[model samples]
Target: MTSAEAVPFRFFSLQVVRTRRLGPSLVRITFAGPELRDFRSDGLDQSLSLFLPHPGQDEPMVPIELGEDWWRGWMELPEDVRAVMRSYTLRELRRDADGATTEIDIDFVLHGVEPDAAVPAGPASRWAAQASAGDRVRLIGPSAADNRSIRFRPPEDTDLVLIWADETAVPAASAILESLPPGTRAVAWLEAHHAEEAQKLSVAADADLVWLVSDDGAPAAIDAVRAAQLPDAERPYVWIAGESGRMKELRRHFVNERGVDRRRVTFVGYWRQGLTEEQLREQGE
Candidate 1:
């Protein structure tokens, strides 16, 4: 919420225009609709709530209106009819030369959900794995005129940038990297479960990217962040996202071990190792 201006949340009905497999685990779903023109996404780490349909359901159920009290209205709906709401980062946004938004891209992490799995799949991942063109869903996004969900806040006169992200945070990290101003100095350490998930990243800043594949039985993700050598600067900003426990470790390393100002570090827990997102929300995480 630091970068974008204030705007009331708006409801938009979006349909899948295409789907692409970015890697072994990342599925890029492009959504398009007339309402998308009204959706304002201020690049870095912009997130929105998606109302995805439950399994075997034909359509997503959304409230008639979005207002300041939208959560109360959503809670009033029957659980069975209500859509499965989830938070995701806006990976990319495309606009025409005339300044009209055309398409929005979201990258969904497809955690291994085998057909004969012992447990059920998460609703959002299940939807992404099986979704196709013309499939519709709903979203609570920002208005074109104003937005407030982008939370990457670098202090004035930022000199050094450091980042740590797991698979879940890769899309946001990638978008942030693309938004860096030329001559910005950055270092990113990415943790991936498999080698294929480690990707070639493009950044405008002078960045050093280290991809850590854990399937080879390497050290913990936090250890990787701890071992990396950060570029020295007068004012360094740290952005980190990953599993909850890992994020805590990285935050401590930056703030306590390295003596970085606590306010300059932004850490978000995209998920936990054992807990589901619902559980995370219930505990007020």
Candidate 2:
């Protein structure tokens, strides 16, 4: 909110195209927009902010302006006046050259069945749930660095690709798997709350899929991925994401014990445990 020169971010007005259940815990929402005319074709794992109105509010209140002044006003507003905002990943981006329309897709993980369950259903999810083709929602971000599509090309003679993720990161992990070149050797480990929530992903022919369920409350997926043996290769890349604590642990292990080059590995903390979107931002400060 604190306007630091208004970083020149582009805004998009998106309308929900469709929403479908991906798994027991994940839902996929597709959005189309006109501002996407020149939208960059960034593939999976990209992140953005979906701004929402305050609870019980039906419409978004755009600031007469954005930046420092807006942030100051936001801070001074009553607790209920502050709206909720959530971070989500771009699971897919499709642009129609002829139609001149672009569609962006994202997956949301349903946390629980509580009355507050509606909260994690962020602004985007909320809109996706009730919005029709013409209804609009505001979208901001896809940071400059993250705006581009992530293309992972394993070395021709590499041994294998290692992917580790939890429910929050499954969509990106699945995309990464599907993008690998044919005959690429890869191993993916995904963790979810229930076995029913595990997804059947589209991956390269040589990639092996490993699914782990939290039946006994054990963090088996992370442990399995971390404990696996890696074959020596010229250069291998590792991609890991999920809960903040788990991600941090994997990062330290790869950097210290494994001696893997930091540049060759992409580790991200999709979300932290027990922290709201606002708390997460505040803690970053």
Instruction: Indicate which candidate wins on TM-score.
Output: 1
lDDT for each residue of candidate 2 in 79-160, tens digit (9 for 90 to 100):
5655456777677777575744378887777654335564555444454445445545566643233333343434455566
Tens-place lDDT per residue, model 1, 1-285, is 222235556778889999998766678999999977767656478778888987777778766455566666766788777888888888888987877678989988876566765776787888999889999999877774335666688988889999888888888998888788889999988777778777776777899988877776767777777777778898999999878888888899999989999999999887788886656777877
**TM-scores of all predicted structures:** 0.89, 0.79
User: Candidate 1 deviates by what RMSD?
Assistant: 3.3
